[model samples]
Target: MVSRTTEARTPPPPSLWHHRAFRLFWAADSVSQFGTYIGNTILPLVAATTLAATPFEMGLLSAAETAGYLLIGLPAGVWVSRVRQRRLMRHANTVRALLLCTVPVAWWYGLLTAPQMIVVALLCSVCAVLFDVAYQSHLPVLVGRDQLLEGNARLQSSQSLAQITGPGAGGTLVQLAGPAYPVLGTALGYLTAALLLRRIRDPDPPAPADSPRVPLLTEIREGLRYTARTRTLRAITACTATANFFNGVLSAVQVLFLTSTLALTDAAVGAVLGVLGMGGLVGAVCAHRVVRRLGQARAVWLVPLATFPSLLLVPLAGRGVLLAPALAGLFITGFGTVVYNVAQVSYRQVICPEAMLARVNATVRFLGFGALTLGALLGGGLGELVGIRPTLWIAAAGTSLAALWVVGSPLRGMRDFGCRAGGADRPWS
Candidate 1:
């Protein structure tokens, strides 16, 4: 492993709020995030309600949402690296908006089916993969590396806010207009985001003309190799992948648990899910303060370690007094997840060479989200065989174990990233 001990004491740049391109990027992303959360709630509800999908079918639908990350994540990174990221992201948003439009149209014509919804979800996942890779790769260039934590936290806060309002809005729309029409707002979110992206005045830095082009497989291998060799990165990857796999299991059955098991109405379900976003918003707002108090390395592992235990309360949820535990559990999960993400993602962006950032990120997502795909299938099967409650317990336990990957790794010995043996520690790079 190549471990650097240098302190980053570089002077801070102007605040990102003053940067025009970044402001546009942030605004566009905020609009897109609102739509994404709405789709996240309504799509599965469509399968469960209108189509009467089985638990296993729900698994298939959920897996389809992330299948593109497993299938095209690595290759998408290479493509993202070669393109103008702003334009690429715009195209991805447009495609997602168009694909989502098909769902409501099919419903209007009374042609909507579980199969069609799954197909649309799968196609949107492909666009999501492209957009995510481009966005992550483009952030450093847009705001400079020093501002990653601030930028990510802001973006995460927006997403958290959407989570609160989006699900509530979706459930209300479903009650008023049926499940189909609520998707109109979801599609409009993406379309509006794409339009807003056109106003960005700054351009990506031009790639070096003299740089030799490598074969696709060669580039993929290079990225994989780098992630494998970095012990810290490898540990983080393992932690995130394990958590996502189990999270997939939870996602597969969570709605079923709420609606079928608890007998909650669609609007009530949306409100419960919205609570998850509320926790995330608090976490995002507090992430910087936590990092300053706990150090980045500690924040990454310790927060999850402290908070994940709440997940055990989810399976215990019942109709009356028991629901409070589940709410607490979901809130804590969201808070810990966002805090851990802000810390680790910024850490990786700081350490990885800029040339390899996209590839390394792709590799991480391929492994992490690929596991999520498999876990969703497993969760559905388990829910059918054993039951929803048992499956949830299993998922909660498995997710908690994920913190061990980082706790036992080299991160335990360091106070802050690159500060174990260095002089005055760097401000976030």
Candidate 2:
């Protein structure tokens, strides 16, 4: 028999981004994200300008776009577990490309009705959810466990870059060629993504034939159970869900508030959004160092503290000269959001078991996206009743309370995932 020392040898060198498979996947995702940013701007413009949709109709359109996250999130998680994740992603990407292509065709035929747009949006949303879940699950397989944070940071940075450039280009394209033309860009992006994904050799270990297969409900419950039982994850989820809720409210009212109340032009609104992306770029670049210096627990609390005060700028925007302060506030809010997101996502990816990743991610997304839907509904109704400014004030107040969920919980003092095993033995169990 081999000696104990010999049996305890080091593992192989980790794969680098230069690895051909990883390069292909990264390139695909980078281009796909840029396209998504372009599509985001054009889609709403299509609904509002081309179709002449009302505020309620626009809210419904937004709601319909996110509805897939709530409806298919869990079921998609289950379905993904039974298939090869890479193959699933390829199919999903193909479907998304086809669906996006239809929009331009319908526009050419003058058959792009509001109802048809809603249907296309819903279908595209569902496909996106599938692609996202599969794509995230595929990461651990490609990059290995140790490089997860760095890999995620790279992806986030690329996405932020896309946000900064895509909107300006999309807006220009819309002005020149019409709203439908920009969607062709999105379709081509998806097609390129699919081709690149096809080149990624599956690096994941084969699934064990005898691995236990749990019921769908039981699998979901298991995921939730694990997350609820883990202190860091629980706090992060609560904080993120709450943030999404309040932000959703703000999103629903922001354009309306700008256009109707402050009487700002669409061009001005686009400029502000682009500035917000600049702030996000700063946050994303600095997130890793910030987490290392501040520690993860402190970083979690810092997010809201940095962000919530900015909401005051919203009401202040109605005052003539204060509009600059409001824009600054929005920038700060975007910065804090990016910082919080990087930490939270990295932490979750590190702590969770490999097998449960898809389910846990889906469950968290379901809660967060559901909150977004509710917030949009509430914001629309409340804005109609109390007026936009007061509605924004309420959103600010609600957002401030989100930090409370973390303060009293186990997340308050925890420093890292290294302490998790000991903390898992607490009374919260």
Candidate 3:
């Protein structure tokens, strides 16, 4: 058996930015995030503009990106658990970089198709899931459990900044070139990230043995069982799942609400939507402080409740200046979500055993992200059945009630889980 000390060969850093391994990860992550944001925006734009896809095709594109989360979430955890996290991350980025490069090449040949974009989205989302689970697991190795909150907060801020900057950059690229052209930037970003990741020199755990021929389903079940039985994991997963469901409902309708309901020009709508990114930046900035002031455990539940009511503004949203109400609600939601995510995610990282960290993250992503997929379908279906405004009201109502999932759990009453809070009980079965 590998000794514990050998597994964690590098000591935790005092400050992430100054630490060599952490800095490389951070730079790589920032570039990847910017690229992801660009793809997130530009992908749909390409479908609408270059492909001139109908509503059905556009919705299919949306589903393609999230499809991997529902399809490969569990198996990904199992796979990541058996591999070295850093190596997996590097390999995944490399594959994604190569895959994205194909998009522009196809476009350059005047052969890019909607179906091709869908395939690209599907493959990219799968690689993203693989990298993400490993990426979260690797952070605790580099930064230590105590610093997880700070680490996540800094990372969130960078991501929020990317969200703010990426759309504008992608739009600029599309305007200067064409919609398919922005994909080249995403390819370059992934390549840069792979190079940055290669610079890290942390001690890698040994590779998984081919002789250990365990059934894949049995391995996947291990993570599912652990998540199903852990109280905190189950609660947080449920809360996120429910929240994403309602958020999905809004996502399907929000675009129509802005253009049709609010009558805002596309330019004005983009400006208003930028408020959402600013809100996320503010939340990322305030996440650690909010946790400090509210106590980590209580902050998780409190922030959600505080922000839940604000979502009603979306239903009440009107035309022109009246859009302020919905924008304010988005700002509040952004702030509350970042604060809650930082506290809860740090808690998850600290309390999980090092060996199971990747599994736990993957399991949580499976449940929480699966909710988003179902929610989008629900939103589109419901919007068609009733009206968009009624759908918005229903979605907001559902969101207001999602906080109940965490409130009844152990997470509500505690201050912190501590470094070793449930260390002995890492596996539930």
Candidate 4:
């Protein structure tokens, strides 16, 4: 493990806002996040309200959108390793914008079929996976190692704030302008993001010709091997994958629990989910401070373990104003999730070697979020066989178990794992 020594005498780096390249990167990502949210909000509306899509069709649309992660995740990482990241991101954004534009155009001509929508969603998700992987991998390059925590926190905070506003704004736009038209705004958002992204002039290192030309499969295997060999990375990956698996299960049923069991009005349900986004924003705002105080390693294990128990309250949510307990539960869960993500992601970025960062991130994404896809299928199947509420109870138990993966690992006792993810100076303080 590599450990970084802090020169306490050295002052902190300049603010990211003052860094023109970072500012553009931030703006581009902010715009793209909002656009993605708008697409998420409005496309479902188009499917349900305009096309009168069946449940199966809707499910297919979602699957098509997410399939890219399952299909191209590792390859995208390999691609990132072999090319200029910003260039990849720029093209990804432009392609997504064009793909989104096609949806409205097809709809306008009355030619948008369920299959067409599915295809567009699949292609757009492909771009999304590529762009997202490149975006994370590019950050450490742009900001340098020492500033990773602040950079990630700021970026995450931006995403959380976008999550808070984007869906509602998109919904409102759809109501005002029709679902097909609202998607035009999403296209525009991505286009704007592409333009902003193009303005960044980071001195990105070109892929070295002298580097061994490893086979793609070999590259993928090496990333997996490296992550598995790193004790903390492996543990963190297990914890995150566990959480994602259950979260996927919860996500598949959260709406049903809110609507059918709790009998919440649509507006009430929106408000509750909104609270989760708000909590995420709060958590992002506080992450760096919490990490500084708790030390990054302790923050990772403790944050999730501390707050995840609240998930049980979700399955017990009551109807109407009696929903406070569930709301509180979700809020705490959201807060802990954001805090955990900020710390662990920063740790991964700082610890992984630059040559391996994209591949490592890709491998991690595959392991971590791949569970989400499986859990979605599991949740759906279980919901069909058992019922919604029972399925939720099972999922809650699963989420509760995620912390066990980390608690037994190196993170459980670390106090100050300095540079290189080396051992902390003392046990958990």
Winner by lDDT: 1
The residue pairs in collision within model 1 are none
* Residue 165 in candidate 2, Cα distance off native in Å: 2.3
Return the lDDT, model 4, position 39: 73
Angstrom error at residue 189, model 4: 0.9
Q: Across residues 238-303, which tens digit of lDDT does each residue of candidate 4 receive? A: 999998888777765565566567765444444566677677899999999998999888998989
In terms of lDDT, the poorest run of 10 residues in model 2 is 418-427
lDDT of 4: 0.79
* TM-score: the better of candidates 2 and 3: 2
Per-candidate Cα lDDT values, in order, are 0.86, 0.73, 0.77, 0.79
Deviation in Å, model 1, residue 374 alpha carbon? 1.3
C-alpha TM-scores of all predictions: 0.94, 0.89, 0.88, 0.89
Model 3, 340: alpha-carbon shift in Å? 1.2
Model 4 scores worst on lDDT over the 10 consecutive residues at 420-429
Q: What tens-digit string does per-residue lDDT give for candidate 1 at 1-429? A: 999898988887778788888888999999988887888889888788878999999999989988888889899878888778888889999999889989988998999988888888888988988888788878988888889989988888888889888887787788778876788778888988988889988866655567898898999998888888877778889999999999999989999999899998788888999988999999999997898799988888899899877899899899988899999998998899889998988887888888898898888888888889889989999999999999999999999899999888777777688675332222222
Residue 313, candidate 3: C-alpha displacement in angstroms: 1.7
Shift of residue 388 alpha carbon in model 3, Å: 3.6
User: 1-429, model 3: which lDDT tens digit per residue?
Assistant: 875654557774477667788888888888988888778667766665557665445556666667678889988887887788788888888888888888888888899898998898888888889988888888888777778888999888878788677766775676568865678778888888988988988876654576475687876776787788877778888999999888777766665566566775433544555566667789999898888898887887888988877888878878767777888987787778778888888878977777667788988888877777677667767766786799899888888889898787776656665422444224454
Task: State, as a TM-score between 0 and 1, how close model 2 is to the true structure.
Answer: 0.89
Order the candidates by lDDT, highest first. 1, 4, 3, 2
Please give the RMSD of candidate 4 to the true structure: 4.9
Candidates 1 and 2 compared: the better one by TM-score is 1
